[model samples]
Target: MSAPERIPPRSVTTAELLAKGELKVRGQIREASNAVLYCSVSYEGQDAFCVYKPVAGERPLWDFPDGTLAQREVAAYEVSEATGWGLVPPTVLRDGPYGEGMCQLWIESAADSELLALVDDEEPADGWKAIGFAEVGEGRTALLVHADDARLRRLAVLDAVINNADRKGGHLLPEGQDRLYGIDHGVTFNAENKLRTLLWGWAGEPLTGEAVETLTTLRDGLASGGPLATRLAELITAAEVDATRARVDALLASGKHPEPSGEWPAIPWPPV
Candidate 1:
């Protein structure tokens, strides 16, 4: 089958296209744990590729309540937008062919991008940050590392704010030279601490000035009865929203990137 057509730059915003367009499922992204439908959305002659995750297709997890993953995904997008970093693509909660679901604009990752790597050295080289060692094969191990890119550092802060429980390497989508997008956020925003991720390179390090500024913005946006808090209240539980605010406050108070709590696995399984 022919691949879905890419969405070109257009006058209409991607969020509008996703929210109002007619979505036709092109195929199923079988690799995803939940139902991820590759689809094409069109409205007023404008067309774009998107992923639609219907709420009915969600798989129940022991920790998270059932039938809420799709809303969480949308909440993550809202938080991403509040940061003003645009780290997440345009996403909306809309009714699709299958039913109400989360629809997000598709991003075509750059094939030549190299954000992650495994090296034999015990420590990472300059310009690279070490995650930790991983078993590569029989009787061999390698140091897992990711690029010391500012984009990733921003994402790490975002993850911390959202309590992102699964920030695997595969979820990092590098687009052009300057843009990177993170996906698969359905497992985020738990009331408890569940910040599993591979972006631990800056753990315990002081937050950059930019990060502090952005986080302050997030804190204000998440204040009680604030615009962002009001929006998030619709998607996640009141407790979860309050927890998210507390996380932002903690980050701002400490003024440092968080380290592994050791209560949960630092990195996700199938790291890449």
Candidate 2:
């Protein structure tokens, strides 16, 4: 006899499904530094695609403590949620076939969205901001630029707060016209100044009024004994949480987009 057809639940949320559903690994994302499993999670037949990064599969980084990348990814999501920007996809820490891991909803990027570009001109055109020059190959150079979009500006602020060490161009997932999502956040929330990103077009510029307001909210939420602080303590070191608070305070005090520290590489290798 044929098996009965499965029926999906009507009220299950993406977060709920990701946190409580059965995870079946479909394949491995071979390009990732750590083991990234492409899986379908189902609860009461409600299924959705997601990326799962198991803690056991995490590679040791000299800068970051071992076996902490998954937690940091979840912590990044928490901070993103507090910003009310939803920049990171719905992510949760849960047990999968490979044990504990971070499960995030898979976002399909719009094929035609162009947020980063390499132009031959010395300066970027209107509506674009230059991120300095890059060596393409064979001693050739091109001007690297990104869109002067509010979404990217907000992301830059978030990256500053989290001390995101890797914000490659490929990490920016443009969803349709109005929305964008960032992925691969396992290297965030470091206690030190390790902000490496491609979104440096607005460096040294004044923060938007909206950004100031959001930072204020973040400051309050990250106060000692506050909910954000408490949640982050569970994921990262206490010192790292304190550093996050300090970064927010610094942004508020400066009231401007942060410039590269010059101590470390401002942009990650292979920007795209």
Q: Which residue pairs show backbone clashes in model 1?
A: none
Candidate 1 ranges beyond 4 A from true positions:
1-11
What C-alpha lDDT does candidate 1 achieve relative to the native structure?
A: 0.94
Query: For candidate 1, which ten residues in a row score worst on lDDT?
Result: 8-17
lDDT of 2: 0.94
State every prediction's TM-score relative to the real structure.
Answer: 0.95, 0.95
lDDT of 2 by residue, 38-153 (tens): 99999977889999999999988988973479999999999999999999999999999999999999999998998999999999999999998999899999999999999999
Q: For candidate 1, write residues 1-272 as lDDT tens digits.
A: 99999997667778888999999999999999999999999987889999999998998899998347889989999999999999988889999999999999999999899999999999899999999999999989999999999999999999999999999999999999999999999999999999999999999999999999999998888888999999999999999999999999999999999999998689999887
What is the Cα root-mean-square deviation between model 2 and the actual structure?
4.1
* RMSD from true fold, candidate 1: 6.3
TM-score of 1: 0.95
